[model samples]
Target: MAVSGVLGVFKDLDTAIAGVDALNELGYTRADFEVLTNAPYPEGTFGEEHGMHRLGLFPLVGAACGFSVGLLITGATQMAFPLVTGGKPLFSIPPMIIIMYEGTLLAAVIFTVIGLLFESRLPRLGSNLYDPRITAGYIGLLLHAPAEKVSEAAAALRRAGAEDVILEEQPAPAAAKAPQRKGASA
Candidate 1:
């Protein structure tokens, strides 16, 4: 099914909030629309509740995997080679500890990068409906819905005091394109 887009611009914070409420009254949930602004707003400003993410545990998991690999490598080398030096035992504890620590740190970083990419849905940015004026002061509300509901979404935004409502008619998917610079003449 094809999903159309509606971009609503509000004159102020109050109007934007009202527009969001109107959208909700019309049966649109948090997932159906999004609020876009230049500055960060407090959580739940538009009565939207986001799901909690479990990204923090990624580092711990990564560290554990790294530690195991390090232990296997160090222990195997000591058992197989049995190199003795400076009256020290064939199996040294200090060097093995250093190697294990480094491996653990490296794994943690690798896992964190993977987790961030997965959690953020990287490389899959959707067709965003926004106006260049959004950076000037207006608040933008992007609504995504089935093709049949485009009018209803626009109406809801209007009823809530949206200053402008635009229907996006972007072309079909293509190669990734860079965002247009604000002041560059094209």
Candidate 2:
């Protein structure tokens, strides 16, 4: 389903924060809006609660994958090369343990990277609700509301001191390749 929203641009931090609060007072939940800025603002700077992230399982999932891969390699190698030493067993656990440990670590790292991308919503090839001014020092507050309520949201943003207000039909999805900056030599 398509989500309709209003984007409010504020030139100052305080005004931007006020805009966020105004949105909340307008019956918009925390989930209904997002803040965009050229600079980092500490969490809750705008009375907006930063959403809780669920990253509890990424590491465990990664470790499990790594262990399985390690085991597969260790087992396959041992079977492929049956070495005989002085009364030594053909399958040794000590060496395989090392391989398994390394594998687990490698998989965990890979999975962590994948999980970060998922959490961060990377490779956005379809975002449509961005303003070029955001990169030029304008703080933006984008509020998602029902199509019927778009006008009301925009008005609230204006009352809260938004420098510029833009009503977009839907937030555009981000593109896979982030767009190149303007005015730089190709």
Candidate 3:
């Protein structure tokens, strides 16, 4: 893929807002850019759109699958081995309820954790455009556009009182690197 990214680092929030507006005027949409800040900023501070996530569905789907599996396991076990207790039915509902409840709880908890990780963008794949100054309370407006537009983005940022602008090309894919062997001779 073609390389394209311009990161504008600003000292104050107002400058960052101006930078965002500048990018917006340059025809960049909210999806084409993102704001990075160490401190919490209110939503729409940089006119960034609310990111969509399906965290809620994770637990519900997990619970449903867990409950189904629990029911199948319990029912199969009961049917496989006949248990005579007070002449009760072979597929007992009360006994199976406990296993189903436990399974549902366990899977829901696990899936919720997985959902959190997913929603949090854990185990990120690519080396993203970033600046260390953002961690030091600087706001960074990262704009991703075509290579042709990168210079314009950078100039827009510079005019918006950006402390500095960094243009970076995306690195090679991880698969391009040779695999290292353990305890191999140099």
TM-score to true structure, per model: 0.79, 0.75, 0.80
The lDDT values for all models are 0.79, 0.76, 0.78
lDDT of 1: 0.79
Q: Is candidate 2 or candidate 3 better by lDDT?
A: 3
Deviation of model 3 at 98, angstroms: 2.1
Error of 2 at 112 (Å): 2.7
Write one digit per residue (lDDT tens) for candidate 1, span 18-136.
98888888898888888888887888888877657778888889999999889889989998998786788988877789889988999999999999988866554666456777788
Model 3 stretches with alpha carbons more than 4 Å out: 116-120, 169-186
- TM-score: which is higher, 1 or 3? 3
Number of clashing pairs per prediction, in order = 0, 13, 0
Write one digit per residue (lDDT tens) for candidate 3, span 10-124.
9998898899889888887888887889988877777766766699999999999899989999999998998876789988899899999998988999999999989866554
Clash total of candidate 3? 0
TM-score of 3: 0.80
Question: Candidate 2 on 61-161: residue-level lDDT in tens?
Answer: 88998899888998888889887756678787777898899988888888888889888776655434556789899998877777778788888899989
